[model samples]
Target: MSERVEWDDLPADLRSAVEARTGKVVAAEGIADGLNCSTALIIETAYNGPLFLKGVRRTDEPGMAALRCEERINATVGGIGGVSPAIRHRFDAGGWTALAFGCISGRHADLGPGSQDLAAVAATLRRTHDLPVPDFPLPQFADRLRTFLRPGEAQILQGSHLLHTDTNPHNIMIGDGGGEAYLVDWAMPAIGPAWVDPACTAVRLMECGQPPEDALAWLGQFASWRRARPSAIRAFVDATCRHWTATVGDKSAEPSNSRFRRLLECGRTETA
Candidate 1:
């Protein structure tokens, strides 16, 4: 019988393949919670560079398909110059496929209006939104909104666009690529009208201790950049905030599925 393998327990074959393709040994140090998967920081010397290795369980969750889809999306967007570069590594072992990506440098900070960092993120978001969705049957925004609302959130998100389901502070990597910041993590990307992304960001800012006024102003900047309707934006923003307040339990605690819960709720709202 074949031995069961966990993601953290790197297979020698996978490690060898990575070194053969990238021409370097990956001494991967584990990083904290990458949603349902595991992420490791692969360090290589001689300018071979570091990579973030993400793996998913093919059996336990159906959402693993989304992760695979994300790998496809990243591969397509890699040539576009600003997206995360996910290099697929061949793995003959336990269904644990991996992608070697360039480590995005710089810090992931709390977003604020007029902050060069936040502006860069907003700009990058616009760039992504402009990309052709290409017959992508994304989940409906209104339905998701309804699913997420507490009691009155539905009335607010009557119409909205797709959202970057996980826009929390840690995911927004601020890099000096071409003197700009870049957005990462497309695993749980949500399909909403538009405000969904900013609203998520606003809730993250609030969780990070920013005042409601400040979070709103920051979200306004995101709205202006994305050219989304104010009503829709406010609705999603309120939903995200309410969801955060409920699911987060402690304001300072890191939110686990607040993003997913928000997306599901909003989608439910749209379908209703």
Candidate 2:
């Protein structure tokens, strides 16, 4: 996420490799956002095109694996309904793995109450939820959340539905006219209940200053979320609270802790 590598940092051969596809790399700018990719960039080519690029050092197995998974998923769905950016090129050479994705022109989603972006975000997520799980191995949400989940709760969330686990506003792009919302960065896709994505988005909405009741009302549009077991929803809340509270240090926790307080109340309401 932080800026760890710049355009000039890539080896000459790797640069040339990218140039070959881009028709000469005329400009390169680093995009400092998420943490999974070692290098994130926006580059312009002599071909007069700008493309998004993400790369990982060859020696970083986990990083490379994440990118490869993204590449594969894009290969299958990136072209379908503009759900994600299409991969223009991908290659492994010069001790590096690079993927060039069609750069999207848009702004991050605004999850505030009554924001027009909400409808489009909701539609886009519905499309994402409907995508047929491509024939490939994906990690299970239950397994990922297992450590924090208490007895009986793990089983409650287990499902075959595909999930975009990371739906932070930064990752959701609202197109020029705000008619389209694209979910970018497929670094960590998981399989679980259909309600999982909706639940995650609800948290983001609240994080963006929307009240929990309004957030839940907005999310109620999703049938899966509406039909979800109250107990299951509570489990998701408890597990995520435990996970986030445990991971973030004290200084950063207070503000974040405040946000989840209302969400925790919403969770506990399920039990009451």
Candidate 3:
């Protein structure tokens, strides 16, 4: 679970810096989602209206790096249209580094099987794959999960596609009226095979109630998925399961882990 930050608790300098950029913050509401961000808020400003703010202490290197990377990606990934919110400003103030984005008035997507949001999610993933790979160093999926993969498995995960590795339903925002799905929380973005992200989403779909075959079937519509070798797909499943196993420790007690296990079992059964 994530924690919330109160307006009064924010450092005076940080608040003043943000206010200088967007005008006085009339209201600040904590957004109680996303695990990595230390402080996530939806603020209503006197002049800017509503804007989303995410900040982290400079002492937290990983968190700071994620925010910086997000700012960089948002700056470079052109033609994304409304698939993601634009960064309004990024600044360092007080003891923290913060980013402000055009606020998205949306709700978390319902990724359960048969949900109408699935189409929007699929479209977003396809658009993401279509995005031109940025000319900067990004963590390669193969290198990130190498320890959990077999000898040749990591190679299969390498590509130039920009990947949003964490696809938890909460990170997908369904537009309030347009019904479009915007992918948020670019903290774990990477460069990998086009199939990799949709494959990850397949596991998430399984977590939402779709059986392994059905989940995989849904992703099969993507050219990348259709072209992926069976061996590579199996490798990805095994590595993802191992990754989550290390993350949650005991699968039986953790709901996320349990769902990952189900996805692993499905892959194992199909591969066997």
Candidate 4:
């Protein structure tokens, strides 16, 4: 997660553009849980109530592109029941591209072992797996990670199912009254096997104190998980561990590196 821009520091024209859609901005609070955006805030308008605003300067090509990708994914998945927030408005102005989503009065899911939120998380995964492939160009999950996988490992990553690759518990919002879990931040979506998202979730479960076997067991209810080939699972675990190891680099003492190491170890234990 990155520190975001303060509302007061936002460009006047961009603020105006957002306010145009939202009415007078009575209150704006920064949200500090996302990594790429230049700005992420919750705003309360005189008329529009509350909305979550996320934006990045056009100058940041990668960040800007991510925002646009999220917007597109939201639109495509918006009608697929209750998996994501509704996009209220999207616009570019003052050299910034931004989107406002209907605010979710929810908290980040607690993905630790035995947490009740796991059920909602599972349900969300089920609905997401059932969605038809979006009718737009998306990077193939296998192709995106081909360089990190062994010769035959990438084969299992190929499929038409839409995947939300970043399953950090923070990206999953559990409703205030224990309603449906909503997946947020759709920037890195991929088309892959339906099991990919749950596999990613399994990694996070390791982060949250479950061993790989227990984590996989927790997700056994998903048809995708039950039907996944053992080879594919091993490949996914190996490639993911390798990817994170490469990402964490020589800083083996770093906290993130330690977490990745645990996940890597879990994968090794399961497959050995």
Candidate 5:
């Protein structure tokens, strides 16, 4: 069962509505604290199942807009096989938008570092990418990359694909049934050049336990599918590390700085 959280922490209207629907609020607890949103594990009787409540943090107007976009994208992904388990409701009150979704039981998978988990995630990701972009504004990688790159950061945009932006294991759950894996945390999805998402995963997995060589091999498979040139992949990986490292320095995120460093060093050379 998912751990519960305090009802007082959620938006008033959202808590009321959810309580009305579920009959009672079991528990709401933080699952992942991120820049965009704070995910929580919520359980109630009405649904008779676990639910994930994603509370969009106050990140100024731009941050709010991105959070809304992520909600729309997740809803779209549902039309495909499944993406983050369909969102149950979106609560917007007092300028706060909280997204509630079904929570599948199971801890996020740990495929022993660089295991075939990459292949499994990649396959599911491809399915999500294949899902047609209808009316919603698809995330643009080229624009963000160009804007966020440092002076010497490499410009790598060879093949484009829908990316989850944050595909780390914390955001992916693998079921005990078999190779079932579900991607969560869509707050940072972007339609960008290939290898970026996988690279992010590769780095994080390497931190988990996967060897550099094994992680590199997984990246190689991702590159081949996306038709990304090796140089481009290397460049993207480097930029990804730089971006993450900068975040690690933030005072608010100091607690996670060590994990970020480990993520940055996974299969990474001092200079890519």
Candidate 6:
């Protein structure tokens, strides 16, 4: 996640534009969750309660493109019955681009042992897998992971299904007294097999205290998981181990890497 960029640090016109629609920004607090945004804030407005805002300099091509992708997806994803924050406003000018979403009044999900949020998180994952593929462009999941895997491994990961590949605990918000869960930050979305999100989430569940076997068992509720080929799942495990290796660099023994290795071993044991 990126460091917070204060509201006052925003370009004068950009801030003014946001305020015009949101109505006098009474209080702005920086959000430190998602990585792509240069500025992420939950602001209190004179007229409205709070609007979640994210922005980046227009010159930042990558940042702008990502925000734009999020903006486009929010409409479709939010329609899935509280699956995402609805975009309330959008600002493009003053050498900056920003989006404002209805603030989700809750904390990030806790994906640990016996947590109440597990069901809601699982429900959210089910909704995400059922999401309609938007007509706009999106990169394939295999393509994104291809750089980390050997040539043929990425193929089994491809599909027509819409995927929210980065649904770690932080990105899954548990609101309404922990009974509701919403997926945030569609910036890293992709088109892939239906099982992709669950597969990634299983490892995260492990990192958050679920044993490898327990994590794999948790995924059993999803039909997609049952339909997932053993070979494809194993390939994903291999690619993800490589992913963490690349991400952690020389720290091949990093805790995250170790988690994936355990997950790999667990899958192997199931098929053995």
Top model by TM-score, which number? Answer: 6
How would you encode candidate 2's per-residue C-alpha lDDT over 63-108 as one tens digit per residue? 9888988987886559657498899888677898999988887888
lDDT of 2: 0.81
Give the alpha carbon lDDT tens digit for every residue of 1-272 in model 5: 22223457666776777666656776556554445554355565455456776665454565577667767777566524765677777676644566777777766767465365666777776666666554766646755665446554434563446778777677787766676678876767777665566666666766677775676566566534345554454455445445555766556444333333433333434343
Residue 164: error of model 1 in Å?
1.4
Kindly indicate the candidate among 1 and 2 with the higher lDDT: 2
**How many residue pairs in model 5 have overlapping backbones?**
6
* CA shift of 206, model 4, Å: 1.9
Q: Candidate 2, 45: how far from true, in Å?
A: 1.8
In order, the Cα lDDT scores of the candidates are: 0.56, 0.81, 0.79, 0.80, 0.61, 0.81
Report how far residue 140 has shifted in candidate 2, in Å: 1.4
In order of listing, the candidates' clash counts read 25, 2, 0, 0, 6, 0
Tell me the spans in candidate 5 whose CA falls farther than 4 Å from its real position.
1-5, 57-63, 93-95, 114-119, 147-159, 223-226, 241-272
Instruction: Report the candidate with higher lDDT, 3 versus 5.
Output: 3
lDDT of 5: 0.61
TM-score of 4: 0.89
RMSD of 5: 5.7
Per-candidate alpha-carbon RMSD to the true structure: 6.8, 2.6, 3.1, 3.4, 5.7, 2.4
The better-scoring model by lDDT among 1 and 4 is 4
Question: Once superposed on the true structure, which residue ranges of model 4 sit more than 4 Å away at CA?
Answer: 1-3, 211-213, 250-272
Better model by TM-score: candidate 1 vs candidate 3: 3
